[model samples]
Target: MARSSAGPAVAGLTAGALAIVGFLAFQASATAPDHPTQARGDSHSSAPGNGGKKKSPSSTKVPADSGTGRRVVYQLESRRVWLVGADERTIRTYPVAPSSVDPDPGAYAVTSRNMSLVGSDGVQVEHVIVFHQEDGIVFGFSAALDGSLPNPKARKKTGAVRQTRPDGKALWDFALIDTKVVVVR
Candidate 1:
């Protein structure tokens, strides 16, 4: 009787340990930085002559009318954002998955920023740059710590523009309070 009871106790402890380990692994992967290609899941191979070095998406040309000066340009039509330097050059540009409700094409400023938060969509996000709000809906840019961009609920109004983890860090560093944000159609 004693041996049988001990067997069940040991099994319970082992299962509990396994559960804890799995949870920790999930946390680690969720916070890891994402490679650019992983954002779009593009598997295109590099040029045969390039020695197998993959080209980064950052090398792509900036969109037209991204605006001049050190500013954050949110291109609604392209669903992209560009961080332009004061010298009128693009410091970085990346694709973002915007919400269904977009701020009107105009100039705005970074009103607030948060280092980390649980977004309205229930995702863990970092580097949140809030620029605009309308009709009780707050609009901003953020990236999920897990590098995932789940589709927003159709019935909910969300203005969070999701980027990759790296891009989110860059945006957080570049966009300060009162930083100009140009929204172009």
Candidate 2:
């Protein structure tokens, strides 16, 4: 009787341990950033912005060799944007909250800009920079004046790359009509 009881207890412990391990694995994958957008070995640092707030730092070099002139580089996988100056130097680099709908990796030009307006998603936005459009959905960069980064609605089609208010201001000042915007994987 003792031997039979010990066998069942051992089996139970093994099953419990397996379950725990499986749960942990699931959590790890879920927390990991979507693999398609993982940074490609680029070094990043955290630096303070003009407002004394910590800003996401990016490497001085562009994420990819998309072109040779001044442009805005948006790394889809890293979810970072770099404002490259005329001399091929990075003017500023910061993090952005990208939409589920990603623009293809290529070069685009800024078609328009708005100082303030209501986004298609109905959010009050400022410094809207229009870069591309697909089907009927327009894609651009904008920031909420209130400094909020709300989650996109599951059923809404949105392609707004969101930044902090200060970052938005910087982008607005930098990206002008016909400014080259490079989208990179």
Candidate 3:
């Protein structure tokens, strides 16, 4: 009688495969940035100024009319976006390249997200957070993979508010589906 060698060979191969997977997983985790899951105010005013009145773009404050509690605030005219915390504090704010088409100043919610996709403007975009749509136009936030903004001269009516990669990731973490998005003038 001869003993089959298949059992030991399969076991050895499986172990080796699992070892490789574990090593790759470790490397990915080790290199990933330690970004906080929750947006935190950078010692900025926790409350909206002027008795909850809207602040000017020159002022480094979140718009007062952006509603209460945690939300993503998008100011169309200023080309800025603010990540607000639960206490109505401005956690983070940064400039964005507005798309040719604009959404009306109002409230919206994060309706869908795509980690990576070819945007309507034909750019490779990531961390897409779509919030609003009207008259067949869709509004969303994304960061281009090549860090390029849509051409200002192009006549395309894309609604992708372009952001830097880091900002996109931060927004991705903070604004899950159903997250409130307040757009102000």
Candidate 4:
């Protein structure tokens, strides 16, 4: 689903993350919150834990315009990344592109922000997790593992469509805002 450019617009581009919370929840069996298949726009054509070659995003991917404001955080092992978001009791995750490190991953903080990726060992890791919250909410799609209908812009698509990787240069990317707060030890 695509965020309506006609409604109230938010600011800046958010990052695309492979939120684990959501994925685990969706993929979970009857005892868990079955993937709200139609809730948010799933962004892939495969299922989680499948294929094993690519990580699927169980969370939604859209532009954020929630005036609710965002909290900030960072990845544990991979530092130097600004995981911009708010604190929540339940975190919804997606299968984002795994990040590498420079000798060791750098440190990140909500207070400290960095927009550039730190390429290490010939591999550039994730720098900033830009959330396109708008698109996520508007379309009610979580960039799910199979949400590629409404918007043909998602980076995940079929070879028939000849989908190219969207660098997301635009200032809008959806994301999972609310989640269980992890107290890094």
Candidate 2 lDDT, tens digit per residue, 20-122? 5643453343221212122332123333345644333333347856686889899887677888877876676667777657788889999999999988767
Best by TM-score: 3
Question: Model 1: how large is the Cα RMSD against the reference?
Answer: 8.7
lDDT of 4 by residue, 61-161 (tens): 21232112343222233211112344321122222222221111222212211233432112122222322222222111112222111222435321111
**Candidate 3's residue-wise lDDT over 1-185, tens digit each?**
99786998999888767745643453344211112322443523223345843332335477777788889999987777888889876677767777788899899999999999999888789999999988777899998876667554568777889887878998999899999999999
Screening candidate 1 with a backbone cut-off below 3 angstroms (N, C-alpha, C), the clashing residue pairs are none
Which ranges in model 1 have alpha carbons more than 4 Å from their true place? 1-64, 150-153
| Candidate 4 C-alpha error for residue 148, in Å | 24
Model 4, clash count?
A: 55
| Alpha-carbon local distance difference test for all models | 0.73, 0.72, 0.76, 0.24
Model 3 clash tally, residue pairs? 0
Model 2 clash tally, residue pairs:
1
Arrange candidates by TM-score, descending.
3, 2, 1, 4
User: What's the TM for model 4?
Assistant: 0.22
77 in model 2: Cα distance from truth in Å? 0.5
What does the lDDT read for residue 146 in candidate 3? Answer: 62
TM-score of 2: 0.67
Leading candidate by lDDT: 3
lDDT of 1: 0.73
